[model samples]
Target: MTITIVGVGLLGGSFALAVREKYPKATFVGVDASPVHGQLALAKGIVDQMKPLDEAVAVSTLVVLATPVNTILDLLPRVLDHLPEGATVTDLGSTKGLICQLADAHPKRAQFVAVHPMAGTENSGPGAAFRELLPGKNLIICDREKSRPDSLKLVEALFSDIGMKLFYMNPQEHDLHLAYVSHLSHISSFALGLTVLEKEKDEQAIFDMASTGFSSTVRLAKSSPQMWAPIFDQNRTNVSQALGDYIEFLKQFKVLIDEQNLKDSSEFMARANQIRRVLEGIDRK
Candidate 1:
C-alpha cells in the first residue's frame, strides 16, 4: 500500500514514522502546505518521497490528513474530490462533528474514516515527531458505519499495528468528552501560563521557583497558537461550556479555602484524586 500523509507537523510526521515502523513494505509520501516541512520530512526520512497534494492523492491507497482543525475541515472536501476510486482518507483532527457532517454526502463518503488518536505532546513540527507517540494510546473511531467495511477495517488494522486500543463513539459524544478532557485542559494550561506570567513580572523568579507540577500543567502553552486558536474557535460552544464549568469549580474551591472549610475541601480533593487511579487503570491496559 502507498500512504500519503498531508501536513507533516507533529501529528502528521509522527504518523509517517509510525507507518514506516509498522508497515515498512508500504510506500510512503509526505505532503505539507509548508515547503520547509516537506523538505524537513524528506530529510528526516519520514517519507519515501514528498509530492504535490493532488498528485499524491491520485496515487495513494490511503491518505491521512493531520492538518490543524480548521485547515482539515477545508481540506477534506478537496481531498475527497481528488481521491482515487476506493482510496481511503482519514483525519487526525481533535474535534469531529463538523468534519463528519462535511463528508457526510461526499461521493467518496464510504472511503472517509474519522479518527482521533488520543495521543500527543505539547510540541509541534516534523522534528518533534517520534514513532512511540501512538502506541498504547486510545483511538476514537467516530461513526464507523459511514465508512465502507474494508476501509474501516484497513484503518483499524493500521491503528492496531501501532499498538493502539480502539474505541467507537458518535462524533457528538466524542466532541463533548474531548471538550472536557482535552480542550478544557489546554485552555487551563494557557490561562495558567498567562496568569503566572502576568503576576510574576519577573521571568527569573518564575524560572527559579517553578515546580514540576507547574511545568507539567503549563507545558501545553508551548503548542502552536495558530493551530489551537482555530480549534477553540471552531468548538467554541462546547469549549466555552467546559471552561465555564471549570471556572465555577475553581470558584467553589476558592470559597471553601477562604471559609476554612477544611473538611469539605479534603473531601473534594479525595474525589478528584480518583483521576490518578483512573489514569493508572489506563496505563495498565
Candidate 2:
C-alpha cells in the first residue's frame, strides 16, 4: 500500500519512519510546503518520494495529514474532495473539535478519520524524525461512530501496527481533556521560561545555576510558536478555562508562601506528590 504524508516535518517524518519500520513493503510518499523539508525528508529516507499534494493524494491508498491544527482545518476538506473512492485520510492535529466539525457535512466525510497521537517532543523538521516516536504512546480517535467501518478498521490497524495504544472519545471530550493535560503544560512551561528570562538578565547565571527540575520544567518553551499559536487560538475557550484554574492554584500557593505557613505548604506538597502514582502507572504501560 502507498501512504502519502502531508507536512513531512517532525511528526510526519517520524510517522513515516515508524510506518516503514513496521511495514517494510509499504510505499511512503511525502508532501511538504517547504522545499527544504521535502528534500531533507527524502535525504533522510523518511519517504520514498516527495510529490505535490494533489498528485500524492490521488495515487495513495491512504493519506495522512500531520500539519498544524489550522492547516489541517484548511486542507482536510480539499483532500477529501480529491481522494479516490476507497482511499482513507487521517490527521495528527493537536486539537480535534474544530477540524471534525468542519468536515462533518462533506459527502466524503466517512473516508476521513480524526485522530491525535498523544506523543511528540518539542522539536520540528524532517531531521527530528525517529522510528520510536509513537511506540507505546496513546492514540486518540474522535467520534469513531461517524466513520465507516472499513475506514475505521484501516486506521485502527495502521496505528496498532506502529505500537500505539488506541483510545476513543468524542471530539469535544478530546479537546477538553487535552486542554488540561497537554495544552496547559505547554503554557506553563512557556510562562516559566519567560518569567525567568525577564527576572534574570544574567544569562550566564541562569545557565550556571539551572537545576534538572528547571531544565525539565522549561523544556516545552522551546517548542515551535508557529505550530502552537494556532492550537491555542483554536482551543482558546477551553485553554482559557484551564489557565484560570492553574492561575488560581498558583495564587493560593503564593498566599501560603507569604504567610510562611509551613504546615499548609507541607500538606499542599504532600497532595501534589500523589501524581507520582499516576506517573508510575503511565511508566508501566
Candidate 3:
C-alpha cells in the first residue's frame, strides 16, 4: 500500500513512520504546504518521497491529512475533488463537527474518514515526532457509520497494526469531550503562562522555582499557537462554558478557604483526592 501524508508535521510525520515500520512494503510520500517541513521530512526519511498535494492524492491509496483544523476545513472541498474513487481520506484535526459537516455531501464523502488520534506531545514539526507516540493510545473515529465499511476497516486495521486502540464517537460528542480534556488544558496552560510571566517579572525566578507540578500544568503552553488558537476559536462556545464552570469551582474553593469553613473545606479536599486516585489508576494502566 502507498500512503501519502499531507501536512508532514508531528502527527503526519509520526503516522508515516508508524506505517513504514508496520508495513515494510508500503510506499510513503509526504506533502506539506510549508517548504521547510517538506525538506525536513524528506531529509529525515519520514517518507519515501515528497510531492505536491494534487500529485500525492493522484497516486496514493491512502491520503492522511494532519494539518491544523482551519487549514483542514479549507482543503476539504479541493481534496475531496482530487481523491481517487477507492482511495481513503482521514484527517487528524482536534475538532471534527465542522470538518465532518463540510465533507458530508461530497461525491467522495464515503471515502473520507474523520479521525482524532488521542495522542500528541506539546511539540510540533517533523523533528518532534516519534513512532512510539501512537501505540497504546486511543484513536477516536467519528461518524463511522457514514464511512464506507471497507475504508473504515482499513483505517481501524492500520491503527491497530501500529498498536493503537480504536474507538468510535459522534462528532459532537468528540468535540464536547475534547473541549473538557484537551482544549481546557491548553487554555489553562496558556493562561498560566501569561499569569506567571507577568508575576515573575524576572525570568530567572520562574526558571528557578518551576517544579514538576508547574511544569506538568503549563506544558501545553509550548504548543504552536498556529494550531491551538484556531481550535479555541472553533470550539469557543463549549470551551467558554467549560472555562466558566472551572472558574466558578475555583471561586467556590476560595470562598470556603476565606470563610475558614474547615468542615466544608475538608470535604472539598477529600472529593479532589478522589480525582488524584483516579489519575493514579489511569497512570498505572
Candidate 4:
C-alpha cells in the first residue's frame, strides 16, 4: 500500500515508523512544509520518498494528515479532491469538532475519517519520532458513522495493527472532555512556567532549586506554541469554559489560604485526591 503523510513531524514520523513495522512492504511518501523535517524524515527512513502534496495524494492509497488542526481544516477537502476512488484519508489533529464539521460539507465526506490519537509528547520534529509512541495509547474516532464503511474499517484496522485501542465519540463530546483532561493541563503548565519565569528572573536559580515535582508540572510548557495555539483557537469555547472552572477553584483555594483555614484546605485537597483513583483505573487498563 502507498501511504502519504503530511507534516512529517513527531506525530507523523512516529506513525509512519509504526506503520512500516507492521506492513514492511508498504511504501511511504512524505509531504512536509519544513525542508529540514522532510530531510530528517528521509534520513530516518520514516518515508521511502518525499513528494509534493498533489503528487503524493495522487499516488496514495491512504493519506494521513498529521498537520495542525488549522492546517487539517485546509488540507482535508483538497486531499479528498485528489483521492483515488477507493482511497481513504484520516487526520491526527488534536481537535476534531471543526475538522469533522469541515469534512461533513465536502462532496467526498465519506472518504475521510476524523481521528485524534490520544498520544504525543512535548517534543516536535522528525528526529524525536519513534515507532513506540502509538502502542498502548487510546485513539478516538469522531463522527464514525459519517465515514464510508471501507474507509472506517481500513483506519480501524491500521490503528489496531499498531496496538492502539479505539473508542468512538461525537465531535462535541471529544472536544469537551479533552478540554478538561488534556487542554487544561497544558494551560496550567504554561501558566505555572510563566509565573515562575516572571518571578524568579534567574534561570540558573530555577534549575538549581527545581525539584522533580516542579519539572513534571511544568513540562508541558516546553510544548510547541505553534501547534498548541491553533488547537486552543479551534476549541476555544470548550477550552475557555474549562479555564473558567479551573480559575474558580484557584480563587476558592486562594481564599482558604488567605483566611488560614487549614480544615477547608485539607478538605479541598482530599476532594482532589479522588482524581488519583481515576488515574489509577486508567493505568490498570
Best by lDDT: 4
> lDDT tens string, model 1, 43-158?
99888899999999999999999999999888899999998887899999998988999999687889999999999888899999888888888899999999999899999999
The count of backbone overlaps in candidate 4 is: 0
Clashing pairs in 2: none
Pairwise lDDT winner, candidates 3 and 4: 4
Q: Which stretches of candidate 4 lie over 4 Å from their true place?
A: none
TM-score of each: 0.97, 0.98, 0.96, 0.99
lDDT of 3 at 160: 91
lDDT of 3: 0.89
Candidate 4 lDDT over 15-108, as tens digits, reads 9999899999999999999898999999999999999999999999899999888899889999999999999999999999999889999899
Residue-pair clash count for candidate 2: 0
Clashing pairs in 3: none
Q: How do the candidates rank by TM-score, highest first?
A: 4, 2, 1, 3
Question: Cα miss at 244, model 2 (Å)?
Answer: 0.2
lDDT by residue (tens digit), candidate 2, 38-65: 9999999999999999999999889999
Sequence-dependent TM-score of model 1: 0.97
C-alpha RMSD for every candidate: 1.2, 0.9, 1.3, 0.8
Q: How many residue pairs clash in each candidate?
A: 0, 0, 0, 0
> Which candidate model has the greater lDDT, 2 or 4?
4
